[model samples]
Target: MDIKDGKIKIAYLSQVPAPYRERMHELIHQDHQFSYDVIYCAKLEPNRKWELEYGNYKMHFLTDVAKTFRHNNTNVWALLKKLNPNVLIITAFKPTMLYGVIWCLLNGRKIIVYNDGTFNSEKSISMIQKQIRKFVYWVASSFMAPSKGTNDLYNSYGVGNDKIFRSCLCVDNSVFDNLPVRDREFTIMFSGQIIERKLPLFFANIAIELSKKIPGFKALIIGDGEQREEMIERLKQNNVDFEFTGFLDQKILPKYYSRAKLFLFTTKHDEWGIVANEACASGTPVITSVDAGAANDLIIHNINGYILPINVNIWVEHILKLLGNDNLYNEFSINALAMVAAYNHQQAAGGLVDAVNYALAEKNKSTQSNTITA
Candidate 1:
């Protein structure tokens, strides 16, 4: 429990490439009191090649495990035991999480489970998976949720108030920085996977409406996914002035963010869209959906950005407001940059450190109390 001097060993197990993992590693490394390790459970078929590469972490392939359930569950535990981590953190309650909880419970290791969004939504995940996730939520020692909505959802599912921690998603300010004070253009940008949930058609519709009204109005669509072809065809059919950049690396992503006058996020079921944070970090005012977790926490209505319901008319009105008033654009831009500071890497890691310290302190107190009673 005396983590002040004790060298804490923590491990992160997740399939996706966590952007904040390197920053977390660096923070822990610089601090002489803690040691951290990451075991990335990566898929084998088509590799997820990160542009801004994260080094200083161990990688484990999940190919063999993918073949069978027995292999996945048993082998992962063997790997965890070999690592001998003091605290195990699972990013999601997937099959990997089931293995993590079982192993941690058997070996008496602390477990932390993270869920960024509402896991039980009919549009997001299957009913069967949601039921299993509920069980996982009940067993975790601590839960790290990326948004207020997600934290509240877990609490609604019977997770203790103390066990649930609010750790919102953050952006690396080094990669995405404040935009320069220049003549803001009549350009709107939408970045992220072109999927059905993102409501790309809505962005296309906004582009069609705004292009006719404002001169030189354009929409920039970045990233590619299953819905890319459909979105492109829709844009062409509507005869909209939009640029489709097919998948960008983290290094090259800044160019897209810097060029845009405003960022439009229209995700229908996103738990906490980190792209919104990236856009805000770039000093571009954002128009995000009320459903987005980032919007719930970071956006302060007319202060930094606008949080509107899923309606293109409202989006068009907000876009026109930004284009018409340069003074208002500048004001929102300044506030957007200031608002994203609390969601930076340092703040996120600081929260993690505090959570670990709190959990360990409570654990030690309970142990001492039990010893006295015995």
Candidate 2:
């Protein structure tokens, strides 16, 4: 378990912003058995704050390639070769998995590719890309997906069940553990990008209906995206009492989780919403769509939270039920907090370490058996 002298070196190649990359890096690094390094393909210069905070990790800021191409073939293999990582894990499919699988095969390094889920029907890749992804799945030593749905997607591409493992997204327990206990204000909070897919308008409408029934009913929308202006205008037009925080700092987000009575996740389709985990960790129960990846994993319908259809009217009834019944709300909140323990950082890190160990052991056994045959 000794991490010193780099017992296990991990190289993560990502084009995403620093917050996500750094969070994953820190989760892995916390384990004494692993030493992690990140190769960030800076399509845009990282936030100054991110650079200042993550200054210690080995970061490669490249501007030559566009984000799409970087995800596909960003010379991550060249960097992987230099790091000589014992285990290589690629997030998302396509170019990253495609390149990482080839590099690991050529170099005899163990590889695990993580898929939150395969691309949605609307976002499905080209036939050529699907063929390439199938090949990547075939070559990878193991595959780690965040949800059963994602695992099924990998299997659909001919990846064996043994090669695929579920590693659901997680939150740092410490962040939630320290959240200040506050009175629930009978408010529902929706904290994700304002996009058509997320169906924020549905939640806004439900909130408007609930406000008429329950005096203190309100909704808080936190995040901005393509539909921000339109959503804002709609909210104003409807005269819904809601707070638009735009984008709040991660440090300040726990407070919102503490204050809200319920977390409303209206995404009609999501691979896995990590914000659901954040909500649970903050001791707030969530009312989420059955379509969310995390909903299947974390939410026990009527136990932890309700998993309702994506209909606004149905959502309104569920909200009113929770508002009128204190026992139901308290029960959900308590159960939700208890459920968060399973998705804590320690559990996730342990799952990753176990997956890596199994992949490495299988590789070693295969090598030794070949030597014996020779």
Candidate 3:
């Protein structure tokens, strides 16, 4: 992928590709006018996984600077110099991307900031740290926010509404949207890590409660983590009717989604849970914690799914509520599919395209203003 002299050379500085990013890359490649590069971090820390392929796109993987926390890279400057892109998109506020950000700022290139963080989750930063974030916001020509929660945070930092772009934290809806849905039952499915933050114990508790209320209820958990052995042992000891299918790839996840009558996301706190979106797209209703970022935009309490606390009784009650009433289940399923339609790769890629064009257009106006002043 040689950069043409006159083309719109746009480069994305990212940690790595997950399903959402892979979809974005595929869509961005559809446009022939823009020369794009999806740069990557050479490796992730230890056992963490990104679960995406580099594929056929033009990519540059960088050398690591730190061994832990943020995984900053040292190769950003050299890569940016080589690419000399007209627009640079930073996926998060990392020191690694800061090199390219500062270089672009000094060289008069456009910078677009895409972040999924909101005050709702990471709320303990100091005022000084927030001011620094605002400074970054000041220079960024446009922002790509995944949900209303983040967009609100950017606005609080003095970002104008016009400059904010709504990019959904999406899944490949095409894969799950058309899968044949099963007859309504008490079958529940859970996806995501078995880590503590994800509340793997909460999942087991919910399954136990559901079993007590409904005879022959089944719960399928499809993931693995540090607590996998501990959690599985607990589920088995209690004799809960559950199956741990381990970690299934995105391509294989839909089959389980179709088998499920409902989906459970028991995260204590999450910036954005794309699994919730995946569940909705598969026409399976979702019950998520109100603190989950996806809950605000995706779950319509008792309409599509319930947004409740991490209480076992409450979750069990709602699970039974959705299961007992087939009429309500069908309605929620319809709304679930309809709501997830806008948060697909097609719409998300459109938002990115619009953000880039807006940044360039604004820069052009600024240039014209300076010329007129001269």
Candidate 4:
């Protein structure tokens, strides 16, 4: 390992160069003790026209010899070998990560994983996939999970407790928190893709019900999707008053979050929801299902918002209750802003730094013990 200018060299392999991940890099670079480079497989999402605002960071791109998430394997070894980091981090167990871990194992590099999945998702895993991931865990040095479900996932795979570090996800909260405040409007908001999995159609139904129950209620749907036409058709049929703001960039979200009285995210299942975090930062109460991993972290039931099972009736009851009670909504709104103080990108990035140091220290102790024996 090489220490240049007394800084620990760390390399991170990212599936995508997200704004949040770039923010994480900035937070990591802020520490004088650490120097980092991010290697990305793709600059943009594959097979999608959804272009995200990119960041200028110390980053590298690998030649994606194959082009797909499930099977794409890029030429990552050359740069990794040259960098020769003290610790290497991969974001998932995909082909690129598999390639990364193999190279790390060959070079005896310490490995930390930031999986995009949670253990409690109940997603069907084939036996081969399970065995493959088990081997992946076997070679990994430490894991950084974003949610409790992810921590449980690592445990289910037999990873030791000492080898796990929480905080797999975070957004740089400064942008959302520092946004110019807006007056609360009689509107409910949902920000995400309009996919079947995201259930924007379900959101349309909720919007219809909400508008009918609450006076002057309007729906603010901020996103684009395959189900956009479907959602619009349903909205028209239900005679719901809604505004479909075509997909806005991350930077543009705070204003939408600011004016909305309540933020509703009705997804089938997600490891975590950054929108919920954004809502919390903007001081808007969140109404998300417990299926979202960020629900528990960002929202205390009936405090910042309500978290119930993905049941439409239950969601309507809680939302109507919040809307009907001005005092309760204000209380939740205030609590939302207060609770997000600890869940920022800097804090999440710091957890990664801790993981790197812990792994390296363990390696150093093992080496010393071996030397003494010799």
Residue ranges of candidate 4 with Cα displaced over 4 Å: 47-56, 63-67, 177-182, 363-374
Of the candidates shown, which would achieve the greatest lDDT relative to the real structure? 3
lDDT of 1 at 235: 78
Q: CA lDDT of 164 in candidate 3?
A: 80
Clashes of each: 0, 1, 0, 1
What TM-score should be assigned to candidate 3? 0.91
C-alpha TM-score for every candidate: 0.85, 0.83, 0.91, 0.90
**Which ranges of candidate 2 are over 4 A from the true structure?**
1-6, 17-24, 30-35, 43-52, 55-73, 118-125, 177-182, 362-374
- C-alpha RMSD of candidate 3: 5.2
lDDT order of candidates, top first: 3, 4, 1, 2
Q: Please provide, for model 4 over 2-43, each residue's C-alpha lDDT reduced to its tens digit, 9 standing for 90 to 100.
A: 677888888898776666566667767666777788887876
Top-scoring candidate (TM-score):
3
C-alpha RMSD of each candidate structure in angstroms = 5.6, 5.9, 5.2, 5.2
Candidate 1 residues 1-374, lDDT tens each? 22224678677777555565566556655555566666655542142335547645455655522432222444677787777776787876667667877887887778777777663332456778678777776666677777777777777778766766656577675566565646444388888877788888888888888888978777788988788888888878878788887888777886568678888888887777788888888888889877777775887788878999888888899888876888998899888888888776555566565555545665632111110000
Clash-forming residue pairs, model 4: 146-168
lDDT of 4 at 300: 82
Cα lDDT, all candidates: 0.70, 0.68, 0.78, 0.75
Model 2 TM-score (2 dp): 0.83
Candidate 1: worst-modelled 10 consecutive residues by lDDT: 365-374
Estimate the lDDT of model 1.
0.70
Against the true structure, candidate 1 reaches a TM-score of 0.85
Write model 3 residue lDDT over 1-374, tens digit each, in one string.
Answer: 23486568899888755667676676776577678898766545455565656555687778533256564676788889888888899887677777778989878888999888875875777777677687888899988888888888888888887888777778767777434445534388878888999998888888877777887788888898998998888878888888788988766787678678888988988888988888888789999887898877877787889999889998888888878887998899999999988787766776777777788883533211110000
